[model samples]
Target: MHHTARKFSLSVTAILASLLVTLSPHTFAAVGSLDLTTSGIGYFSLVLFVIAYLLVMGEELLHLRKSKPVLVAAGIIWMLLGWVYTQEGMPHEAEHAFRHTLLEFAELMLFLLVAMTYINAMDERNVFDALRAWMIRKGFNYKTLFWLTGFLAFFISPIADNLTTALLMCAVIMKVGGEDKKFINICCINVVVAANAGGAFSPFGDITTLMVWQAGIIPFQDFFALFIPSLVNFGVPAVIMSFFIENKKPDALDEAVEMKRGAMRILALFLLTIVTAVSCHTFLHLPPVLGMMTGLGYLQFFGFFLRKTLPGSLARKRAIAESRGDQAALRRLGDVVPFDVFSKIARSEWDTLLFFYGVVMCVGGLGFMGYLALMSEVLYTGMGATVTNIILGVVSAVIDNIPVMFAVLTMQPDMSTGDWLLITLTAGVGGSMLSIGSAAGVALMGQARGMYTFIGHLKWAPVIALGYAASIAVHLWINADLFVK
Candidate 1:
């Protein structure tokens, strides 16, 4: 099934490329050197983009990877734009724009790769498993665990991505809640809300915020101004739902787990890496990825140290086992183990990286064709920034926030810093309104399966909506000075 889908995507992309090539010269110069936005090719490009996004939205039902269709769409869209630019004697314009978008994706991809490697390394060393075991051993009642998990998700997501934070918290929910579906369902909702809300205030917290930060529209420290509003967004929904959780204790099993050697060091290295990335961007004025790549070197050297010492450590253990005449222990020590940093890199999320590539290129292509300018005129200029930004938050609840945020950035509307921050907060937290809205919410649905279904999340939409509105109101009131300038 997967192979067939791959072939279909490739075939569609090839057909589109060929069709563009075969179009009459008249179609290329339809308006006699007019703007591409009003030309025949522009309309065709829009149709192609719409079809590609429809496929992206239907990924769950279609049983196809979301990246495949968008990858194909991006290629075809750019190919057509390239042809038009070449015909107009401005090929460099197209080439430069394409390269610029690729650069953006490159920085994002490398930054995420280093972060994911550290996360994978920590996971492999039983760091997360140990944390899970500790929580379970606490044997807290359902209500206490509910608040505890929710608050943890809220705080942890600012450091880790919201998706990862949600997955970890969900694991605790499933383990502790056991067969009590109600406890599991409500807790999952709280995690999603808290994670999304927590991510809104930090550039590292969400992809949308990262983009805004990279674009130089907002400074790093200014993001913290949203901290109060973000808390309100998460706390409102959590306080309302806390009443629904039954006061009961889950059955506990005693399981003691220890983190493998170097787990703590790797975690510390990750924190240092984040600081390096921020410092490089803020002080050195270098691309943050440069610092991230440097941090990757730190891991590589530490991994080498662990590998170099393994045999000596294993030999000493084997010697002790032999003296005790414990044959099983001696045999187990015979297998030497070493940490390999490359393995962690290899385990990073390639699908997500590629999806980002497609989104950036496809949106760049549309912006080049003048669609985004038209959108800016209608949405930002016509509707005004404040109203348009609020509507965008609601729209994000239906569509994925990545594309919506990307398209807005491409528009480059003239708005105040407060407006920029408002959009950032909305785009990040708005996904909490629907299970399918944000990556964290979608992942939790899969992790929790039947207990956290779309309908189940939808039933609480009104309550979540309340938090959403409350957040916006608080932002407008508390940060009123930002808008004045």
Candidate 2:
């Protein structure tokens, strides 16, 4: 079934590509050389982008990878720009645009790559499982567990990605809920909301916040200003939902799981890497990616040490065969384990990374084409700034916040620091309102499968909606000073 759907999607893409190429060559000219704001081509580019976006949003139904259409659209948009530049007899503009895109892509990609590598390495060492085991051993009641998982999701997501945090917490939910479907459903929503809300206050929390930080639009310290608001975002819904959770205790695990051989070490190293990244960004006045790459280096060195000391089965077997004395086993161990960094990298979420690639390029192409300027006019100028930003946040619940925030950044509307923070807050937490709104929410749905579906999440949308409004109101009321010129 999926195969057939993919084939159809490809066919559609091929048709679109053909249409793009078949367009009149004279449509762009060397004399005037069309810009993105040019009526026909600009509108066409926007339509193409919108179509690609819709396809991305319907990825599940279409059985298509969201990256495919966006990748195609990015290529077409750039080609259109290239044609315009070529016609204008000034191809340097296109070249410059390419350079700019490459610069941004490189930094963001490397940052994500290192972060993902650490996550993969931790997973390889069963770090998450060990944490889960510890949690289960506590044997907290369902109500306590619910609050615990939600609060953990909120606080932890600021450091770890929200999607991963959501999945981890959802595991706890399922383990505690057992066969109780309704309990599992509500807990999943709480986890999603907590994760999204928690992610709003830190630059490292959400992709949108990361973008804002990397863009130098918001200082790292300013992001912390959203903390109270984010807490309110999580708190409002949490308080309302708490009444429904029954005070049933969870079953205690019969056996506690031990951490893997180097799991604790790896976990410690991961924390160090985060600190290094933060220090570099805060003190060194460098891009955080630099710090992340440095962290990756630390992991590599530790991995090498582990390979020598903790070789895998094949090495141990080889050592056993060569062992004349007890020490012979240790000496021959270096050949087998091999410090598997490549494996960790290979296991990292390439799909999500590539999806990010397509998004950045598609949005960048739109910016190059002048659509963002129109967007600025329509969104910010036509409507009041605060209302527009708030609406965008709500829109982010349905559409991905990554692109919405990217578009706003590209438009570069003049607003106070507070306004930037507001947009960041909204974009970050807005996805909690819908299962499909945020990566964390969507991920929890999949992680919990039949027990926690989209419709199930929507049932609690009213509570989450209250959270959505409350968080914004708190931000407006408390953070109003920042918004003043």
Candidate 3:
């Protein structure tokens, strides 16, 4: 399957490349005036985008990485656009557009890199393990565990991200539920829903919200404005799902996993990093990425201290003496590896990050070609902004929200602040309507495997759709001031 997918992708790229070469002169001349909507290149760009996106959507079945087709498509589209600028004898214009795309991609990647590093550092410290151990030790009833995991996913996702939070919460559910497949399945759904919803209200939560915040379409304070609506989104489904859970208590584990040294300290530092990032963005007139990187520096310093200073501290001396086996104790300490940021970066979601790059360029190419203008007119003007934004969420469920949100951002539709918030809310939570919709849902599918399949999530789609609609309605009512304009 993988080999066949690779061959298919290469063939597509080659065909697209040949077409670009054949149409190079005409394409470049057509884009000279920045009005390609009537040109052949414009329609061609749209076709390429759709094909690339479809390949991305069928990633699982194709056994192809989502990044491959889109990356190739992005390059081809931009190359074609660049050709247009070249033929127009305005090469600088193409450079400018490419530079703009690169800049945006850099800002987003840096921000994600720092955030992911902090998350990886925390994982290295066994922070999640500590929480999981506590839950298992508590031996909570199924209903209690259900709600607890759901709410935790809701709140923690705003900081840790929805995909990671869902996976962590799923681990807890799997641990507690043991062989109860039904219990695990429902809780997984609830966690995916709650995590995605929770992520909607915070800039750090979902990629869509972050993009909106970073693009300056919405103020940082306005992100909190959706908190209530996001809560409603999660709470409604959680309440409905709670009644479906059995009340029996889970079995306690025979042993608990001990947390690594500096686990609590690392967690505290992670919180401080969040504060630093927010403060920098709110007052320092700096990008949130700067503050996050600053915080990462702090962690690196502390990691060095742990790797160098702590082992030789008086506390270690006392423990060494007590053990009467310095070599053995030293060996144990040696087993505790320091937080290596580079390794974290290597392990981070490279595919997702690369996909963002492709999506940005592809959308930028479309915008330059004026496809976005047409989309804005159709969706915002024809369908009405409210309905269009709501529909965007539904589209997000079918495809990844990252590209959907990017395309919307590129379009820069003329809408009120409330409309922007509506799109943000829908894009983030709408993915919960289907198992493959959001990263959180898709990830849980792999994590829980046979226990929580697409069919299982589909069974609960209506309940999730209810939450999706109710949350939008709630946002419309409570935050109506945003729509006043």
> Candidate 1: RMSD over Cα atoms?
7.1
- The C-alpha local distance difference test score for the whole of candidate 3 amounts to 0.76
Q: Cα deviation of 413 in candidate 1 (Å)?
A: 1.1
Candidate 1 residue-wise lDDT, 1-485, digit = tens: 12222222222222211221111111111121235687788888888888888988887799888788889989998898788878888777777767666655655666666766777777767777787788999999999999999999889888766776777888888888888888899999999999999988987677777767766677778999999999999999899999998889877868677676788999898889878878887888776677778989999998998888887877887789888999977765554468988776665445555666676677778777878778889999999999999899989999887778778877778888899899999999999999999877877777788999899999999999999999999999999999876
- lDDT of each residue in 1-485, candidate 2, tens digit only: 12222222222221211111111111111112344676677778889988988998788899998778888888897888788788889888776766667565766666766766766666656666667777888899988988999999999888766776777788777776788998999998999999888878886677777777766667678899999999999999999999999988877875455444677787788789878877887788787778878988999998888777754555556667666565644544443345587675554444455666676776777776767677788989999789999999999999888778777777777898889899999988888889999877766666678999989988889988888899889989998899997
Name the runs in model 2 displaced over 4 angstroms: 1-34, 311-339
TM-score attained by model 2:
0.86
How many steric clashes does model 1 contain? 0
The residue pairs found clashing in candidate 1 are: none
Query: Is 1 or 3 the stronger prediction by lDDT?
Result: 1
Model 1 error, position 52 (Å):
0.8
The candidate maximizing lDDT is 1
lDDT of each prediction vs. the true structure? 0.77, 0.74, 0.76
The TM-score of candidate 3 is 0.89
For model 3, residues 428-475, the per-residue Cα lDDT tens digits are 999999999987787777777888889998998998999899999999
Clashing pairs in 2: 30-87, 36-369
List the candidates' TM-scores in order: 0.89, 0.86, 0.89
